[model samples]
Target: MVGSLDWTAAGGAGDLLAPPVAAAVGAVADARAAEIDPGLADTAAFCEHYGVPMEASANCVVVAAKRGGETTYAACMVLATDRADVNGVVRKHLGARKVSFAPMDDATSRTGMEYGGITPVGLPAGWPILVDEAVAAAPEVVIGSGLRRSKLLVPGKALAALPGAQVIALAQR
Candidate 1:
């Protein structure tokens, strides 16, 4: 119901989710999953092809923060119409001297998800999931299902309740 896609209980659609996502979906209340053409997984493409609004779509980006001799990884969720304020809000929030988008290969390997489908739902334990205030306030939003061929529909509040989730003003208009 998020767009033109047929949505079903995410807990019952393990086949469409990554292993970690399938395992973690049960923890997100009221989450729904819908299959889609993998080729249209990108935000603009998926939104346009499925008649979804940009405001209802959220993008999850992995960031690397380094301080001293250690590096930390975290996930940032923001509405598709906005952008994550990485070097500003995220770096300061993570308490890192530097912050940057994680390398695609590193992000994929560490998160165990496809490049374009990494999501906050199944991120490694202890990694923070920073959700923008606007995203957390939305009634519902579309995010990747940890796979390119499907998407997950979840209440913004549910994302804010995930373990390690922190709602803050992390998006730049």
Candidate 2:
């Protein structure tokens, strides 16, 4: 029964979304969500089963990079058709020695969302959100609503305007 929720009234499911994400979506004029099975949550399967276009779906990845013996984190969003240039662009942008996907546990716990459903909307305020230019150029895209059982439909501009979010050419191909 998660059909078309305004982020403000998302109910118990709101706990799965980061506090800022929950509030921010409500303020985004075009944000909305629809229910789906948690089992079909990952991008490919969800897209195939629900008939969502791969080009219009964005995947949010949590990355951790090491710089001067410290681990810094960022949430990167790229179109499902492209890959995040983590080792090259991300590491350089973060000024870190190396970068990799965040450990599953760290990502899930830190974002307060399921492993496959972490999104950029409400990531920790300090964790930068890098949205690939391709994704930011789309009119609208489907992203995780912070729960495995739902998906959020939002305008690309809304994502680009998220706190600490930057629109960059973040894709590898």
Candidate 3:
């Protein structure tokens, strides 16, 4: 019976990771899987569910700003220990008077990604992806997998390679 067991079938049955996320992670060298059942509505909930040591995980958020009557997107990657200083750094970087976290519905709709699953990798081209330097320093960091139920463990170098990601010191103490 053990020899006859289908590992793929068994693994697929309870997979919390989405296919796209899995594929993206798989494409990167030195990336590993860290599946979690995070019934995450937001970063805090995600951290809580997975018991991710704050020192090792990153919180990825999408901020929206209206610049010259045009809506712009900013992908902020901050360490779990600190919050993205959206109004301070993000607004200044985007050159917008008004900047805020995009509504969940808007984020999901625009990115075509689920809440708690959005990552800088494989996002639409031309979006500004700002990664906190702290996150980049970690040997391995956990990030959302483009789906809520699972997270992906990727090396910092792999994340920096994602399109348009600028490693910046933007996290608030």
Candidate 4:
């Protein structure tokens, strides 16, 4: 069980999310394992090195949107095979006139996750974590672990349980 296992077993950076987020995910049954790899700067390179099939991987991206002059963050989960329709679904979902991918600096700074290794698990609690319905339908999904070299293989359901996660049809075919 997650409680019995030393979560600190991998002694590097701690969970990216606050205690409650990790606790909620840890409470789920059969949550997949997290593996740390060497730091990767891009998705294709990370997938090749880790032998992770691109089809089975879900890419998590942080998009910034302005609603009523207030900036907000939305965590969009898209399949590696598909891209998040930021201008379409994301803009409509957030009711923003304009939205754009957050700058690299902003993403890294806020997430505590390196460029290519951002995962939904430990994201800041308030951000809306949207999962592409396709990802939720998969048997197993590979995702970032808040570290460039690390990844977590979790069941779709477990991913849905993360705090503030919403399953939506937000991926482009």
Model 4: per-residue Cα lDDT at residue 9: 24
Count of clashing residue pairs in every prediction: 0, 0, 2, 3
- In the range 1-173, model 4's lDDT, one tens digit per residue, is 22111223222324533332344446544555444446553667756765667787789999999887889888999888999999999999988988999999999888867777777877777889888898888777777666664555667777777778889999998
Q: What lDDT would each prediction earn against the true structure?
A: 0.96, 0.81, 0.71, 0.72
Model 3 alpha-carbon drift over 4 Å, by segment: 1-23, 40-51
Model 3, residue pairs in steric clash = 117-146, 117-147
TM-scores for all candidates?
Answer: 0.99, 0.89, 0.81, 0.81
Error of 4 at 52 (Å): 2.1
Q: What value of lDDT does candidate 3 attain over all alpha carbons? A: 0.71
Candidate number of the best lDDT: 1
Worst 10 residues of 3 by lDDT: 1-10
Q: In model 1, what are the clashing residue pairs, if there are any?
A: none
Model 2, range 1-173, lDDT digits (tens) per residue?
12223333333445545455676666555676767788999999988888888898899999999988899899999998899999988988888898999999999888877888888877887888999998888888888977887888777888898888889889999
Ten-residue segment with the worst summed lDDT in candidate 2?
A: 1-10
Select the stronger candidate by TM-score from 1 and 2.
Answer: 1
lDDT of 1 by residue, 94-139 (tens): 9999999999999999999998899999899999999999999999
Error of 1 at 6 (Å): 0.5
